[model samples]
Target: MDETVTAVIDDVVARAAAHDADEPDRLRRWRVLEPDAGRLLWFLVQSSGARDVVEIGTSHGVSTLWLADAVRSTGGHLSSVDADPDVQDAALANLVRAGLDAHVTFGTGDGGAALAGLDEQSVDLLFLDAERTEYPGWWPHPVRVLRPGGVLVVDNAFSHADEVAPLAALIDEHPGLTSTTVAVGKGELLALRSR
Candidate 1:
């Protein structure tokens, strides 16, 4: 990340932190990914050399920016999905400000629908940070869309353990993937499809 991009990210993180702190209702908060988690996303994309990446949520685009930068580094592309058009707009603006808008494609509507629209075994990396309860129902899509050797990352594993438990269990039991948890930021649950 360049100094300019770093500055933009720092601004976004600070603003999001303030928003989260000021908002009394959890549902109304920005709920941006922690900076550590953002760095993890960047690392995963660079290390895996992921070319076609999908992100299930775009809240203010903190995670999206991190993923977009990584894709920019790899000369890849990121497809980001968010149910709320307004939030997606905010994310888009952030990406543009960071000069990373060119690296991303925004999908506004149901995250499941967006995932369903993708071709089978096409994506190199899939990141899930949307509504937790919906994850179990979105299964097989993640299973189907990820190419062999693809990566799956779900955020808030430890912070929202109960909410993400069922999906975690599903991933754990999948015969074709190996899974583990990383205690970063909100805690990330990572899995890789067998090559």
Candidate 2:
């Protein structure tokens, strides 16, 4: 990462850590994105000039906050989905505290189904951080909704490499996308549309 970007990520992590410390319940339930992972996500959004980002999971809004901040900087918007209402409520509070409420929209329901309902070619950035084992099932719909040249970021792709193998294979078979696996936080697979 560039020095300026590194500094920004450090600041974001410091803020997130402080917030997490202030809320023990949230800290217990959600793992805030490590500095590097947060930086990567921020970089992706800025690089892509993404105006509409979709996130499949919003645990305690840690990643949500990170993405929202990046989107706000770019004058973009974020829509996140999570099945747990409690988690969504907590995430909402976190986003509010972060002053990122204006940039975010939260949906409560099955992530896959929620994503499927979105209009095609509507999202600029799609992030998957939900159940690892359900990645394949959750991935296709998001890809379908992404516009040509959109980016898909899948978290825990390396940690759950076995579970993600099929998805990886599919990506490998597809000529329209290119992916890179990074060992950030848990692990992240970033697939950018090449078509």
Model 1 segments beyond 4 Å from truth? none
Off by over 4 Å in 2: 1-28
Using TM-score as the measure, the top candidate is: 1
Residue 190 in model 1: lDDT = 95
Best by lDDT: 1
Q: Kindly list the per-residue Cα lDDT of model 1 for residues 22-114, writing each as its tens digit.
A: 899986788899999999999999998999999999989999999999999999999999888888899889988999999999988888888
True-structure RMSD, every candidate: 0.9, 4.4
lDDT of 2 by residue, 75-162 (tens): 9999999888887897787676667789999999888898889998899999888776676676667678888999988887777788
